[model samples]
Target: MNSLYWGEGGRFGPFDEQEDGWPNAGQVMRYFREKSNLSAETFALLYSKELEKAGKQNKRGQVTATWILNMEKQNLIPLDMERRRIIARLLHIPPVLLGLATLEAVTIQSRKKKPMGTLQKVTIDLAKHQKSIRDALHIHRTSSAKNLMQDVERDIWTLKDIEAQVRGDLLYQIQELLLSNFLLATRIMKDQRNYPAAYRSANEAVRVARQTQDNDLIATALYTRGCIKAEWARRGTVFNGMFQLDTGKMKSAAKDFQGVLQLEQETSIHPQLAGFTRLQLSRALAMLKLGPRDAKVAQALTMVDDAADAIDADPVEDFYIRALITGTLTGLHAGGYHLGRSETLNAAGLPGQALAELNQVRQLRQGKTYSGDETRYQAWFDLLMSETYMNLGDYPEATARAKNALVTFHQIHSPRNMASIKDIQSRLALSSYGTSIDVKELNDMLQEWYKPE
Candidate 1:
């Protein structure tokens, strides 16, 4: 077990010996080739073709079989982030799998300070607008969603103006719109259960980002796309096989995460956002059952841990981010424990710990008299606690938690949420564990409003 920090200069023998260490590009290349049923030569040719398709390579100069062999040897670690990203994308793998060094660790030979260019100045301005938009769309906003949406529309136009001075300004404008749409649409889609529309908006966001030629934008868009894709994948795609577990869409999601890995040098955005994106990628891989272990999982997990640690690093500066990151990591730990990531149920020690965090979230909400969506967030936490209990097979406790969610949903007039409670109730019924309320009472409630009039 060795340890290394991103800023500790050059390579470190590693982190904890238990840490999965660096992922070998050779292993990922081999996995994709075998899974696609292509021989070594054929795989390289196909992958090289794919890179060309993405406009990442000079079509006149083809990658040779010998060159592919050298990469597979795993001796030459990729020093260039761009090359690493291209390889990860071509191989249908996560970029974090490539093990590139961090920008924070890059030491400058001279101390000449370059003035912030127009592009940098414009980007900083865009970031300010982004922050303002985010603040306006705060979950605790007192204004109606319609009023908030009007403000969002105004900001979108403002984003277009700020982005207009840059090269490929139209594309940047579209990317900004897509980014805002991605966040708003995905949040609506998730809460409303409009998975198809959500996927469309998220994919559109990625498409716009790709057209913008900015790695940071591309990475952020991909990260957003990956999050939506993961949620959809877990629900399964009964209609379109294109979105199935093994399809390119999953790989696309992975590649987008890799995009983030590749653009590490251009991370002018907040470190907290970058870290959160990495976490989103980790969750995507987990849903795909392509965890960061075996040969290619280390990079993925490293990104996840580093991102969380980065948030933890500035406790005072990133207080909200730290709390959110801790809550997210705790949830992931509990999820992995339940989903067979480890054999020992209690080994993760996170099931109870996550509940404590949720309690904290609830207390934080209480401090400010939450209304509307904020109140729903509190109810959402309650529902998650119930689901966790169910995952732990604590039937009585799960029933109680679900009941609480049911009461809250009805009070809020949320039919969709009430339906989710019914779904949970159905699961409880399958186990033959009766709720504290009469079965007839529950049925009557479901039948009265949920049934079509």
Candidate 2:
């Protein structure tokens, strides 16, 4: 390792003294200087070499030991952003350690591979470095699920401290990053079946979104909150004991979905947002309408139909959109085909038909899914199929499908889904099938998993 590349390029490596988040520029200066074990004068020699190598002619000609001294004491400096970049490169640290986007973000922006909406030149310049920082740092929930959570969680908390120093559009950008982190954490908790924790994380996202007045962001946060509630009502063992399908948490989820729609009606939302919101609403409604004759089921089907007609009507051709394939599952067509139709079929006492439809959907998903949504999509589908088989009194198939879903959840370190399916595991334990070989192995695996490390 180079002398400059200390702390794993930031607060995460050795020299892990107690810092709140990634270091500010002054702190970076101090950490790297001390780690080099060089006098400020000698450090200035390296700083000068870096500036000269970059062909950067510093105002006041060159940096001196006193300049380094002033910076270490947190005094503001001129040409700060550029000089910081030069110093970061000198120290062989990640640009992020200086609260800047990674070098990759700059390269991506230079190529214009991604657009940043309609920002004028000044705003573009202001946002250019920040354009993809959040995405670069954020881990997909199913990817790196077992590890990285603690590091990312700490980064999310550290962002608020970063937020206080900026103002105007840049501040909004930081807030958006904060909101995104909160949403990502919300997803993690929800996947873990920590509904209360998920709800709290989601509400923080909502607060950040509303503060920014970005309507689409606000809608996403609200919709995510609805998802947490709906998932909890469906899978939370404690909540299942307290609330039936028609009312309680399911209805609460319905209300939040309705609120998103209401917001959409008041604004011009993205077509995809409308599609996702309606499809999720359909799930809540289908769950609420347990009886065959219930009108809500029909209403739920209507929403699904509308989403299919609109969101899935066009064959996707956008380059970026076309390129993002998540394993073997892709767009709204699968969500509508599986969650919408299969869920309604199950709720309407058509478990056989639902199982058939689900199998068909699985076939559709095999070896052909969008890269972004594949794991989550597959995991949820497996869990739903398990529930449907349980309804049909196929305990073996139910246990098998449940185990399959558990495997994905386990891969992602999701205890919530594990717990949700644990109930089915327990019910299976009460039957003659409990003595079956596969069931016994699953029981043992789950026991080992739940044990404290």
Candidate 3:
């Protein structure tokens, strides 16, 4: 396969810390500064001035220009993790990238034609890199974090931290990390169009939560698992870029939600958590009504109403729970809209409601009050809003919302979202009217329904 296609230029070489020296965060700072066309001393001056503005003196109550330079040279500045993260953000580089002592290089090479029965070589190289990363992760898992080399040390440390805290006071941290990983894996699988993997990861998250002995963790995991199950059922575990709906997946999702509800009944979990989980379950079941069964749809609607009642009984200041509810509600709205149930639209205000929910999400982000999973959950809401507006024949609105979603999507590195937005833009471009679907747009979407695998 490697012979079938060309590879990129670059050699895979070791990143030597002692030889190359620790990464000068300041050098990176300088790189971003140059990229932004700012003076080298601008940031240093800004920091100094900001210190003065805060009624504090510089290191010697003097100019910080040389001090900044010294810090850059020694790679000893950015005294705090948050500060380092901020600098990384300002520089438009990943925090992880900045710590890299040496970059792994890959160079593309031209393909040479061979005899018949040969596969492409380019694909092989790409596979090799992916396998390498996965293999590294596996190896790191078996070793102690302190014993591991720097390259794998960070991941090893985090994994060990998660493991060490899973049964202790840091159980919350474990649940949070597992939840984030589960969500990340879910998005990845969805992007690769691999539903089975997404479902498996989601289930694994639930299992981890159970081990944590945290009711909040357990319930939240179940809620998220239900969502993934619903998504799989709605879209089918198989995909070919078509929107062919699958009822079996929805039923499976519904079953998962039921499992959540059953657990809620048995455990003394937080009321808010239980309420939110039941709400999610209702949303999953609601999706099942997309079939011709009117009775089932009615029952699903009642379940949703019942969940809503329960939510009203729960506390409102719980930001995490609110984030979860918003997500589940958005899903319900989407499922209802697709099922051609007028009542679904009436019961839910379509994407318009989702847009309002995103405002709350924005508040959550600004407040810096949410954990990583909640942040991603809010981001998903933003994506939902963009998609909803797009579906309602509002191209400009859709495009703007899509752009916001793209920013968050890139941060999270979800390929599935990137692809979905690309398809949406293409549809918008081919439409005669900028807003609203004409016959052509409808035809294009329908074509997607029958796209080949």
Candidate 4:
């Protein structure tokens, strides 16, 4: 089977096609409609009724089967804003797909209907406000700040109102704002350990981006969704005692990442974003827990290395990307030793050597400023240190590090890490004091925290 046609019926199939000579808007619309089992005349009738609801008088005067046919043939352009919107709604397609020029004309007409500042000015203000919220999230590692949450919520409401008044080219900008808000919401909810709400926000971001027909935004939305799914999977393991791989969620995330990579290849835009997508793809693969000797694990390691190289070569200098790639490389290298070499080292009683590998992870983070989810990396480092101390027969140090790890995990609301820390602490207590301690109480506490309020 051709790799190109692999998983053709999957959720990401729409994004798998080669880059060159992509179909135009009309071709895309026609293909989707036909695939939906709708006849041209049937679609035309529904579209005509939609136009009528938008105050387009006389279906025969505005549109007909012939007009629909011409539109599908790319011979007719729906330059009218009302008609464009109605057609988009009826066909369940983005108005931007109609054409950039058509979308720009619609944007200009929509701006004329606004009572306030110019479109450019309003767009700039919204972008700045969104950026401020994003910066706050990065600096604080949360959206829990009262004033900031209030501002973000207020901005969301304002965006909804603005969305109702804008379409076409400006619709992309509005969708970008919606994506930002929802992405932020997703992160905030995730930080709060509210997986369901995080997933909801991510889904909304994808929906909004789809309406803009912007592949970059759509890819970003997919990435956000994938991250949320992966987090949920991680939480499930931590809270539910399901140690087996969450294959379903990991597969879904891989599909999303693959879709992003396909889109990037097609568009040739945002090379750094593509690198990030590849990094994420590597993560999803790693989470499968394929044995270190497995071919898939080797492939995933290669992907991690290749992604880091690509990011290093990106002309656009992004500190966040640099930090992320560095941290990822460090983690992957540590994980390789933990999964493969550590077993042999432990068997040989050369635990100190294993400790050295884990210590390298900490050294890599020195003087680095991580832009996103810094707590996660910190908690991971603490966990690694705790394990290393345990291996070295320093039970007291191991217990202390485990307790410290628990604090960091608690701050991040990471149930899985907390559970792992509790287990480590229990082991250290038993080994050093000859007192067997049950972690059931700690596990129960985590269960309560996992419960939705």
Candidate 5:
């Protein structure tokens, strides 16, 4: 065996004697390309002409592939915003991922001591961008929302350098901008399933909002944090079979929701916001796994009814708000209220009434335009239908609905719902065949769906 030097004082013989050092951007690019089984020549051939047509040709008229080699070897590093943007687009990654400033950041950096009037204009523009981002989210255009948030993040970072130079209303404007950025970042992070990052961003939003003493902004931040906690708690539950609650996490989530409600009561902002908060609190309470007769469950149902009436009376006209209310109502009818009623009826030997309540949820879901809400609503609807059919002894329909729910859950990237559907399928199989079915194959499939990137 040949010896080669590895890290400090570590060696294998001659074969391993190749140089070891930190790879530059170019080297990293080459390494990744080669690892992907792409030859430099082939990679160049693929993108060179496009780069040339895009006018990214170097002084020697070499294309982007040549530039990549130059970048790898530390001979050239593109600093122009256009070049960086082109490269990032070609690579399908952010410019920051390539250790380059985004175009927005670069533009902001080029400005020196921007006038307050200009900043005010910028603030207004940023607010408009935020609204656009919200619109994207409303339409379930997650990638667009994320890209907009990233732009906002870059602009905020660029402004931070000049924070001390600004004063008075300008400083306040800057603070509000920072607050919005953090809050938006929190939302995008949560959507992407990066819960920890979302929580951190929400906390930052709260800190900044508190500095401004803005009750609305603070409430928004608190509401966001509370939602994150509730989701985390929900994910912690053993979702297979019946919903087995994780009491500790559920309690923590309940406390977060209660805190938000308390803040709202103290400050008294938008009545709709209060309704929204109460809706979430109701959801948390409903999912506590208490029996139907539990006072808490009844209270949760009351909260849901109250929130729904409030939301309907005010009419927010926001897609997400409407979807959320619809979703919550579906949940309340399917499991929170109706499911509890069904369980109680089943326990009382009244299977027919139990099935009727479950069917009511299906009726409610019908004739509603799901649109962008398809994945979520479909999963819930199908799962509830499956359970209802099973209770009614309609095994075939139960099996089909369970499978459909599984597929919908997969589409939505919901491991918990997938697990629940699998459980239901297993129960259906056992009921029909007098033997439990093996779910090893389904488990393997779900493992692939949830595998860490």
Candidate 6:
């Protein structure tokens, strides 16, 4: 029952404990091979061939079997990130193994820094754009998303120009600048329901974060990526009228969310990031389209409960996060406990109690002036409420809410949600309510709104 985790703690049970208080990378490699019953010779040969096939050329020329044995015999840690990766991939070492960085880390390092970040050293002017990139993110609902994205993109280009001429810690600040701008771009794209563009922006944010090798920033990047993917999977997919989960994409999003949690266990994660990530992970797991009694459903419920508990215990007084994934999470979620009952019940296809949960949330929010975050939630709540009514075959209520959600999503330039509203239209189209005048009118409105430009 000894702890296996490292905070440079006492030696964990059954692990190869090095005197230097870190896992010996060389022994770890051997550990994986021996676990697989792979002899040194066979393991080395396989490693060599894999490297050759991948066209890897190390400083020691061709990696040989004898070289591998010698390294193991001497407990020589392979400082070369690539060689270690080839070994890890070939042998399938567990994560947290020393000498192994994520496969993404290698790609981030090898990819040349974008020339945009470089200045002709002599022309370096940090003052020109230093504050500009940071200011770009000071955005609110008053700004147009498209125009905001364009401005941010320009700011990113300028920041890159500033980055090229700096060295030392200014470079790190620029990296954060790049990460922040890219994340903002991802959000703007997702806000517009432009998932592909969001994906690209998220990818860049991850690369920059990895290049910095900062765990908290990396967690943030992964969280943002997971959220975008979740939205893309649920909203951007074409309507099949079945309301079936996009299992593959959903699972991918879950993996990304899970990766952030793994990083959390290994290192300190920002409280806000940790809280929001768990919320997103819970939504993904709950909606895995599994049976009610399935393991994922239980796991999903547990995650949300943990999130609520953490919020109550946390001391951070007044920061908020507007969380949305496939329109599953509500705004006003992060700094507080969002009752997961409604979300889970809705995902489980139990609309009755789910609607009640929504009513409860409404009561809690009843007297407050609708803040911007609440305004966002109101639009999404309209969609969720619409779906719940449709599930209960209450078309009039569903249509009214769907129409309301559609107008809000459209007004906010959220084409993704607007398009998802069609799923309601689709379900109603096949129902006995298919020929109702209100249904036809709703259909016509969607057609007109989504028509042409």
Top-lDDT structure, candidate number: 6
Model 3 over residues 14-45: C-alpha lDDT tens digits? 11232333334555455555667766477667
Q: Which ten residues in a row have the lowest lDDT in candidate 5?
A: 9-18
Over the full model, what C-alpha lDDT does candidate 5 score relative to the true structure?
Answer: 0.53
| Residue 437 lDDT in candidate 3 | 48
lDDT score for candidate 6 against the true structure? 0.64
The TM-score obtained by model 5 is 0.53
Query: Which lDDT tens digits does candidate 6 get at residues 166-278?
Result: 54444665677778778778877877767899999998988988988888778878888888888777766564543445777778899998998898799977554566667
Stretches of candidate 4 exceeding 4 Å from the true structure: 1-124, 142-151, 237-244, 289-293, 315-358, 364-377, 384-398, 409-453
| lDDT per residue as tens, model 1, 55-85 | 7674447776676777666545345567667
Predictions ranked by lDDT, top down? 6, 2, 4, 5, 1, 3
- Which residue window of length 10 is worst by lDDT in model 1? 116-125
lDDT of each: 0.48, 0.62, 0.48, 0.55, 0.53, 0.64
Tell me the TM-score of each prediction against the true structure: 0.48, 0.61, 0.43, 0.55, 0.53, 0.63
How well does candidate 2 score on lDDT at residue 147?
Answer: 52
The top-ranked prediction according to TM-score is 6
For model 1, the superposed segments whose C-alpha errors exceed 4 Å read 1-136, 139-178, 236-255, 265-269, 288-307, 312-373, 407-422, 434-453
In candidate 3 the C-alpha lDDT for residue 286 amounts to 52
Q: Cα deviation of 314 in candidate 1 (Å)?
A: 6.5
Report the lDDT tens digits of candidate 4 across residue range 18-42: 1322224456467557767778888
